[model samples]
Target: MRYVLGIDGGGSKTVCILMNDARQVIGRSEAGSSNYQSIGIAATLKSIQSAICSAVTSTVKIEAICLGLAGVGRAADIENVKVLVQELQNSQLLPIIWDLQPSNIVICNDALIALVGGVGHDVGIVAAVGTGSIIFGRNHQGKTKRVGGWGYILGDEGSAYKIAIAGLQAALKSYDGREISTSLVENFKQHLSLASIEDLIEVIYRQGWKVKEIAALAPIVDLAAASGDEVANKIIDNAAEELIKATSTVINAIFSQNSGLEVITTGSVWRGSSKIHERFTASIINEFPHAKVIFPRFEPAYGAGLLALQRLTR
Candidate 1:
């Protein structure tokens, strides 16, 4: 019996699942963040191998594998990752060498699998907010468009990273007396273990700032927003608005109908807070009055496995 393995290589973590030819899941595993661009290629490959091995260990030796990974936009990078995985599989001496795409790999940008998770058919959009964010969709004519994903430095609007940045800006503005904000001074000090903005500047200039490390404060922002911190509320509201704006851009590009189009959203950000989801949904409906927002019925790995099955059946 042929067995297929699927992976969703996300920035926060990696999810791997093994399935039989009949499409029954046999094993599963989780690994560290898999964004090759962010974590470096070596770490990403290690995490990918660990996840795949854990999920394929007990039963169903993998005959094929499909991976939807981050930082796979460039052809050179894709080939490098394929070699890395193949080399690992060989070093352990586990299985016969096989064509990487069919036996061990199918590289894809993270957005595509999220889109697959949203709609089984590749004819709709998925806008997601996580540690970072991006919007991806394909139309009926096999045309695809994407916006964002340049990372926290240049893009990633509406992401946890963005939220954290906005919160920081608001806090600075409050300190400067330029805006009236519920004092996040204490929260920032506590969160970053710093007593002064000088400390923040040191980290940003002398010590090299890690935006994602600050982004870890996003949950705190969410809590503050929920507790009625006006500035915090505004930051999150703006994030939600931008996320919807991304959805609208894709829908407008592909679906030019008066009744709107199929739009689905799924991610850790939407999963955590119903209030945020409600606000985001309200923003979406304002633009696409007839657009339907469906929660992902399956994890992205399941969708990748289904895609493999689709290939097999054809």
Candidate 2:
């Protein structure tokens, strides 16, 4: 039986799945982050190799492998990933042999895999919002468009980090009587175990909180919004509107207004209790009536496996 390997590597983790010709997943494993741009090439290679080694139980020659990684958009970044994959193929730690041709190796950004896996097809839009946000869409004509994804420094509108920052800002403003009252002040204080709102300065700056750490506090805002906190709800509304705007841009760029397509929502931000997903879906549907908004149908690793399998046919 022909076999293929699919890998979904991102900033947080790497996932590997072994699938056969019949599209049956035989083995699966995970490792640490493999975003070479963030964790460096050597570490990324090691993580990929480790996940591959753990996923392949039997001694089998793999036909193809697809790696969908984060921060791999630019041509230079793609080439760098190609070199990293080449290094992985030459590694001695893997148990199985890869009988890969140049066409058998598929490398792409994580967004594409999310699109493929979310809808069980390659043609759709994926609005991913985590600590960062990006909107990517591909039509049947093979044309694609992307919005946002500039990271936290420049962009990342409608993302969890942005939401958390907004919440914090509102809390401080309310404390100083510069803005309307918000439950966010108490929520943040309780969630972080801070003695006062002023202590947040030390917690954020002095304690060295990273993007992920800050993003984790987004649930506080979400919960407050769910409980009918006006400011928190406004923050959620703004986030939904931003995502809607980004999604609308992608729909208009590559998809006709009447084109029936899926717009998949991926990542932690959509999982919030504030009903942001519903808000986004309603707004998108209201704007582009033919668009179907959805969550992922399968994990990205499965989509990578499908892409790897497609290489054999091509």
Candidate 3:
């Protein structure tokens, strides 16, 4: 039976799934993120290989492989992944496509697949706020572009990472007696299991935590906001505003032919019970006036695999 492999390589984790010729999932595997920018090409390739190996488990020919990866937007990164796939093929690690670039190997930004999950039927937008945030859009003609996904330091403004960091800052402001807010002092102590914020000093100074770990606190921020914390509410509002901005930017950029558009929200943060999603959707509808925001029907990786199928029909 012919098989296809699809991978959603995010900043925090890699999710790999193998589909049969009939598009039934036969194998699934999970590994660390294959983001070359964060994990280096060698490491990324290795992680991908490990995940693929686990997915295969048994020897089976692969008809194609689609990798929706973070930090793989550059042509050079795509070429590198192609070469790595070639190497795996020669060694019989897994079945590889004979030709590059959509020939058994298709590489695109992770956001592209996210868009596919929602806007498959018509032109729409996909905004994801997981560990990081990115908003992607595609028109009916398949013309797609990125709005904001600059990463946590700069953009990624609506991402969980952004929210969590902002929450920490607000907590610090409270500690310094600069802002009036919920008992960040009490909550943070419970959240981090520390005697006090002073304990955080040592942790921050020497034993640093991974950014994902910090981003994990985003839900807590949402809870705080829901519980009536002003600082947390502001952070959520800012993130929601940023997300709205990303969607608008893409809709305006590509939908010049028709400002009327469909928008689908994705990712953990958007799916949560934050009033932010409600506010963001309302803002989008108000501004665009004709935009129809909907929920995504499938996961992004499914879209990536379908894109692989798209190449074959051509």
Candidate 4:
């Protein structure tokens, strides 16, 4: 039976899935970050190679392979990944042999795979909010549009990082009496084990907290909101509104207002206890009533596998 490999590589981790012609997943494995922009090309290649090596268990020929990676939107980034794939094919270190055609090697941004995996198809919207955020959409006509995804400093409006940052800012504001009283101050102090809220300055800057590390604190805001903290709830509301706006933009661009489509929410931000998902879903449905909001039907690696399988037919 013909087999294919699908790889979902991101800033945090890389996952590989081996599947047969019937779309049955046979092997799966994971490795470290493969986003070349964040971890460099060498490390990205190493992670992709490691995941692929660990996933393939038998001598079945891989007909095609799709690598859906983060930070791979630009043409230069795509070419770089192509070179990495070529290097993998040439290397004898893998347990299996390689004779993949160039056309069968699919490379795309992680957002595309997320959309595909979220709804089990390519034509939908994906509002992905993790350490960062990006909105991507594709329609039946093959047209596409994207919003946000500029990273933390520029955009990522409705992301975990943004939520965490807003929570921290609200805490500081409460501390200085600049804003209404909020439990965020105590929550941050307790969550981070800080003696005082001012200690957050050292933890955020002096202690070298990364974006992901800071994003991990978003649950504090979510929990506070769930417990009836007005400031925290406002933060959650703002995040949901921003995502709604971005999703609306995508829907208008490539889809009809009444088009029946799926708007899949992916990543950590949607997992918050603050009912952000319900808020987002309600807003999207109010604006585009036919749009269906959903969680992922399958992991991104599975979508990558589907894309790889599609290459054979194309």
Candidate 5:
């Protein structure tokens, strides 16, 4: 029996799935970050290898491998990952002597797979907000457009990282009496287990908390919003507006505003109940009355698997 491998490599983690011709999931494994740009080629390859090894146990030939990864948008980035895959195939640690060649392996930016997985199709817009945010859309003619996804430094304006950072800043503002007092300060102290506001400095800087850690704080802000904190609700509202704006930008670029578009919303930010999702949905519908907003039909890795299956047909 022939099989295929699908990989979704994100800034936070990597997921690998092994599937057969019938689309049955036979093996699944996860590993650390595979963002080559952030983690380096060697580390990224090592993580991917570890995940793949755990997922493959039998001698079945892997017909194709599709990877949807962050920082792989440009042609050069795709070429670099192609070379890395070649190294993985040559590495003695690979579980089997597979039929995978560069031609059989497909690599694309993570957003594309997210779109495919979210909508269960190749034509639609995907608004993904994880630790970062990006909106990607493809038209019927294969024309594609993207907006946002500038990373935490430049943009990622509607992302969990942005929301959490804003909450932290609001907490500091409340502490310094620069803004109206809110539950955020107390929530921050309790969540981080800080003795005092002064300790936040060490936690943020000296402790070296990174993007994922900061993004984790987003739920806390959500909790505050749920409790009816005006400050928290306002933050979520602003975030929702930003995402709506970005989504609109892509829709306008690739599809007419009046078009009947299917919009798939994915990522951690959309996983739970938040005012952000609600406001984004409302705003998008107001702008594009014919647009339909929905959640992902499948995970991004599974979308990659579907792409791998297509490779076999080709």
Candidate 6:
């Protein structure tokens, strides 16, 4: 009769999954961003708490709650979130009663759950690319390693943000006679309704365009590539190579065996038909002939539930 709650809190949304001890899913709910770094502690807690309450009935007793969240990589972040969860538990706003001690509430970075969700196990690599990019993996021996999650400023080499930035730069360069002429220049102008290159500065900086806004331009680059723009194709091709390199590094560091490696691609950028996803898949397969690239079997929230179950058993 025991149940566990798993929450995956990302930059934009929070998802909670309720699962029974028999591994059957009971309820699933979603809320807004629960990233404490961006939304602050109170709002983050509110989002997570709301998702949990909506997921299960009031009579259900949760044996454990596992939260895999963005912006929780540091130990201090974990401690802070733990304190917030405790406060929420004592607030009595949640529908179900928490049966276990404070230790039963497991908290970790979201990448770990994405790894588990993608491969359906504790061992494998997850190369998740979105507004930001990170590669996390765990080996069969329980050893783990991570690479290339340095965020937008210093890293995020193969992310949507990166792709969009590169496209913008190329468009500007082409306009300034510094790079090869491509359709991206016209695409940018048409997409953003800019009359000239001069307006781009005002639109991006003066208009307060940020990471997400700039990232929205990535599809323009994709369009240009689809139309046989060599410059755009090169940009996507290079991005794919960077992601492959990061994935290969994690695989080499964690799994030394020459056999097939289970590598999962998660996030919006990897989904559906995109030049980046296609190139990344081909490049990774070329590098590791036995590599099996797959999508996540369950969303990361369910993976967080799996982690909660593991916490109770451990």
- The residue-by-residue lDDT of candidate 4 on 137-237, one tens digit each, is 99998898999999999999989999999999999999999999999998888888999999999999999999889989999999999999999999999
lDDT of 1 by residue, 1-314 (tens): 67777788877899987777787787778999988877888898788778877876653355566778877888897887777667665756333234334434567777877777667655678887887888888887878989887888889998888887787778778888897866566688787799784577776667776776777767767777888888988888888878888878888887765744566677667764427888878877776787777787667887677666555555
Q: TM-scores of the models, in the given order?
A: 0.85, 0.98, 0.87, 0.98, 0.92, 0.96
* Consecutive 10-residue window with the lowest summed lDDT within model 6: 267-276
lDDT of 3: 0.77
Prediction 3 TM-score vs. true: 0.87
Off by over 4 Å in 6: 272-274
**Candidate 5 per-residue lDDT over residues 121-235, each given as its tens digit:** 6889999898899999999898999999899999998799999999999999989999899999999999899999778899999999999899999998888987899898888
Q: How many residue pairs clash in each candidate at the backbone level?
A: 0, 0, 0, 0, 0, 0
Relative to the true structure, candidate 2 reaches a TM of: 0.98
Clashing pairs in 6: none
| Candidates in descending lDDT order | 2, 4, 5, 6, 3, 1
Model 4 accuracy (lDDT, Cα): 0.92
Tens digit per residue, CA lDDT, model 3, 1-314: 56677788877778788777666778888888787887787888778877887877776766677889887788888888787677666665555443344466788888887777576543578887788887888887878878878877777888888888888778888888888856555777798898877787766656887677778888888888888877888888999888887788888888873467778788778865668879998998888778888888777777776666665556
Clashes of 4: 0
Q: For each candidate, what is the lDDT?
A: 0.75, 0.92, 0.77, 0.92, 0.88, 0.86
Which of 1 and 4 is the better model by TM-score? 4
**Runs in model 3 lying further than 4 Å from the true structure:** 1-3, 20-26, 54-61, 95-104, 121-123, 256-260
Model 3, position 171, has a per-residue lDDT of: 86
Residue 173 alpha-carbon offset, candidate 4, angstroms: 1.0
Question: Which stretches of candidate 1 lie above 4 Å from their native place?
Answer: 38-43, 58-63, 85-92, 95-105, 190-199, 202-209, 258-262, 271-274
Better of 1 and 5 by lDDT: 5
Q: Model 6 over residues 8-106: C-alpha lDDT tens digits?
A: 999899999999877778999999999899889999989988888888766688889889999898889989988887886787777777687777888
Native-vs-model 2 lDDT? Answer: 0.92
